[model samples]
Target: MKIRKIAFLITFLFLWRGVMAQENSSSLAFSAYTDVYYSYFSNEMEPNALQPFTTVSPRSERFGLNVAQIGLAYDSQFVRANLILHWGDIAKATWSEEYNNVQEANLGFKLANGWWIDAGFFATHIGTESFLPKNDFLSSTAVATYNEPFYQAGAKLTYEGSDDFYTEFWVLNGYNRFLDNNNAKSIGVLFSYNFSENTSLTYTNLLGTESAEGSAVKQYRIYQNLYLNTVLTERLILIVGGDVGTQSNSKLPNMEETAIMYNALTTLRYLFTDKWSVTGRAEVFNDRHGFISGLIPTQNSGMQGLELWGLTLGIEYKPDPNSYIRGEARFLDLDDNAALFSGSYSRHKRWELMVTMGYQLDRVFGF
Candidate 1:
């Protein structure tokens, strides 16, 4: 009798465990990825030296870790949540002075008629390049660095309508501020239209006040972005993006004029084989008021507008679905008399070469 009772108890527990596992299978998931790279700059900077307007490869001529992220997500019929942890230079640049390493922490719930609302820190919807290098076309564009917002802490309401249209409305802290920089809040909206499986267009706009509390000057920033993606052939794709922005009450002391900046870029990507591809990009960025680039006028140079143009060519080789190797060469040309490119003296051109390796692990422990 004792042996039979023990057997029955063990069998009951095993069945219960199986039931629980089945129930959780559809509700939880895990994912992670790592990106490491070595980069060399032709400017002759030391390893680990600071490179202006560059984030992923800030330190030239060195091996560096770009980003490593781990994420866990939960989804159900009515509710969903995601938590992502980040490490390496991507985190440092994304957060800046903020100490938190959380890349995304959001909670959402489904509403009626294909609507959903989410609240928390989320990646910005304004840029074509993602914080993760693997998701980007080449390394990154200069426009992505100087002109785009990295992340926003906010709440958003999204609607997925018929006919391949989608929209989002957002309310949030000041631009790029994980924590509120001031009492003022920002507002933004995004619209996307998918013409077909091969083509799409998106527009994003944001208006916000970034001034500190009790400051004499009230600074406001208005930003706009437009992006287009098209597949010209089964193996060829193209992307074009542009940005226009202005900030009132420039931080350049006693300057009350609106500072205007604009950037535009186009990228072409072609796949030669299932595992090999090439990408090229051309970009132009202009900081008309010396406000956007934040390069203060030196006594010799005075306060002059700054203009930059860049060209990038990269090749990628994927060994498997989960890993890849990429090599890229970038050339940058600046306006004459702009010393921002080379620290020692004013130069018109610069070059960078980089190689990256990436791997991803998804659903490692769950269905």
Candidate 2:
């Protein structure tokens, strides 16, 4: 099975290369990259240690076709269509066989009235890439966020008639469940207003989900985002955002007493020169599930504990528009004198570090 899959991928790659090599008037395109990384852990424990205890090795490498974006685009009036295929995370093994895992094809049509309609498994239209968190390079070491990443398999519409206001709505599969009838359904909405070039505000909401256990619980989220461009001249930009949400019957056990998760983050980006820039970010998470708040477990199936905070520090390097790299280090303390979420006997501390690199090529071929 592995050999057949690899052979098929190679054949597709070569055929794509030949097609791009053609001197025709088509807008099809492709690009790919590799991520090589190493990470270390402090106070890490074995898999059976307890809640928040996970295994970490000295070195691990993940490789795959990073991004293969293809589309039919025309630049004349108000008409465009894009079909993007992100060859993502082929080595995860467990999640590689998902029906929605293969390709993300988006069909978009823009109208002259500033209204657009898009249907496909496209990149999420939510706040920050954090909404569709990329954990390949920087896994969720400590803190947990309310939003999950890249919700496809639905239709989204956006309206941008005015310079100050824009709104987007999407009806999609709640999480990444693909098109399974057993999975929950979800609706996502985004609203943003730009008072000026230097300032803006935005909000996002995600709701309606049913667990595989037939739990009719729902999740809701709200975010407030602020951006200031003139903190000290036009070279510095400051971003501050907060997200709060309710997750009933979370995938995490012993913390599912209708747990609530909220996060606060602040970042400062300074452009020392036109080609070089620096960014510093600090984040904190407050997770109060059940036991940490001193609430007794309702039954043997109820939650038993709590987690207070997690921190992240990262720096990014962007030499040009086509490439960027970021390194992130984070530490999480899962101490509340609580029992293991898995009904185990022990609990441990965890720390994680990760790095990521991304590049975009506009037109990689010469016709």
Candidate 3:
């Protein structure tokens, strides 16, 4: 059986590559990237300890590798495919154990009209922040980004009718589920509008279930994400993003109560010179029902949730267009310090510092 499966995979790859290579104007590219960092946290913990609401540069008091990835991309007039393989602490700490090394793999083709369909694993369509280090303003993620879905699997139907207005419809296995947890299927949608070259707004949402296959209580979850980007000045950029989600309370069928969570963040970046820039960010999270943040109830506060605010400041230097070195400082404050969110490493208020350097190289060729 193992031999047969390996043979089948090899054959499928050869066939797919042969078909794509036969295209009249096919383009292919290979990409490599790596991000390495060192961090320090106020709360002292063991080297193996995990940080709260952090993925990039997660470990403290040690040098770490966030990600190192190799990617391949192919595109023809009507066909496109992308595959990325990665490893490091980011994958082990935040991704699925079974397929953590596989960051993204998807195939897409155009339909009869201006519509297109893509199927496979993909980055979630919810947040402005991404897993890639160079794409984010700070070295770490905000509370909103930490709680949001990072990746998803299924299919997307996208409309390419206009450049100013964009939309996508999704049929997913479940919320952030790679292999499908239950029999239930999920759905999502995204809408983006560009007012000008420098200003845009995006809204995306998902409706799904988080219950087990045959659990007695069926809980339905709804998540909403929104962001706005604008170039406020010649050398300054501003981005605002937020998330809201709700799930059926544990009470379930008896009372139909719901648990809601919401968060917001904003970032501003100012370029001081051609190769240097500074960024500042402010963020807040509230999970009164402790639905998504994993805030468990305590004796003093029955069912009270986790509420916190944080601020970040970072400076970045670019030696060239393909690489960056950034240093950041962040501080977080909790409303009541009594509840902890991310396992045993949580603290009421904490300070952290992170420094990372990222580099990427891509080679493009045409048939």
Candidate 4:
């Protein structure tokens, strides 16, 4: 009788364990997405040291397949993690012709009391997307800038208590602008407040040092970005914002001042249909002071100060929840005394036409 009772208890516990496992499997969720791009860029004049002219062609240099990032993420009430993999060399070559063996990865978790923590390699959460504004195209904008483009490995934490407010802080492997595993490191903090459903504001700060050519220099950089968003009606959305940044401690062989670069942009988006949308933007930039030795000063003999303006008009079409295509025409004009163009001595301007196709995957390998 005693032996039989023990056997019955064991069987009951085994059945209970099996049921719990099945329930856990049902609650787990997984998702993934990928984006492939081809880019062609051209400038009126050849590039200089600040902006190198390494492309073989003048009017158009077709940089190979930019990159297709495969993202895998898994989530549950208690934990989560994300992984991003790329096509290696093709992506590395486009970043810098010298470096190889490149990949990006990130890992994150949730803590008690609405605390979120993450660590690994990732891009800074800065600015709105330059194109395809509706999609969460965070990393893509980094690609267009060609600066701080890839993931910087480190740790980040966030506190999101309510729908109206949140704050985040991060320490990263400083602006690996292009490649990875450089000795530079930095720290950043961002605070945000959502005024309403259609409006939000953000403040950010970053500080670090960078290595260039054959030497390394310490740098103190500060930036503040303000974003104002509103829904004009059921069909229109507007976002007006600007950024001001100043950098000190550059390694320029001969110079005494830090440079100040700032930009302002106004963007408008209108939805004509559920699948079609129209967008426009006007942006201006100023680079009056060149990065001198340890001080901030005006430019030298040539057009030292640069001022440029950009205008963009585009249409976005979303065929499904997972895919989108967009076409845009960009026009740029530099000030008569700006260093980017020689319009003061000659009559010339630079322009570009771009088209983008992006896709988001819902599942990978039926997982």
Most accurate candidate by lDDT: 3
Q: Candidate 1: where is the Cα deviation over 4 Å?
A: 1-25, 44-46, 161-163, 251-254, 296-305, 343-346, 364-367
Residues 33-139 of candidate 2: C-alpha lDDT, one tens digit per residue: 33334444453345322223221212323222323333333322344445544333322321225653444566667765878877766554543323212222223
Candidate 2: Cα lDDT at 41: 46
Q: Give RMSD to native, each candidate.
A: 5.7, 12.8, 9.7, 6.3
Error of 2 at 236 (Å): 2.2
Please give each candidate's TM-score.
0.87, 0.64, 0.88, 0.71
Q: Per-residue lDDT tens digits of candidate 1, residues 177-263?
A: 788868889999999999999999999988999789889988899988899999999999999988888899873454787887888
**Residue-level error in angstroms, candidate 4, position 342:** 9.6
In terms of TM-score, the best-performing candidate is: 3
Candidate 3 Cα deviation (angstroms), residue 36: 0.4
**C-alpha lDDT of candidate 2 relative to the true structure:** 0.50
Model 3: per-residue Cα lDDT over 218-284, one tens digit each: 8899999999999999999999999888898543233368877889999999999989999999999
- Weakest 10 consecutive residues, lDDT, candidate 2? 48-57
lDDT of each: 0.80, 0.50, 0.85, 0.54
Clash number for candidate 3: 0
Candidate 2: residue 133 lDDT (0-100): 21
lDDT (tens digit, per residue) of candidate 4 on 1-367? 9999999999999998888765444222334334443333445344321112111111333323334556566655456667655552234433434323234456667787779898766655555433222353222221123222234567889897789988989787665443434565677787888888877877665666544434545455555556677787999888777766667753234334565667677778888998898888777766555331112222243435445677777788889967777766656666654334332333224555555566666553311
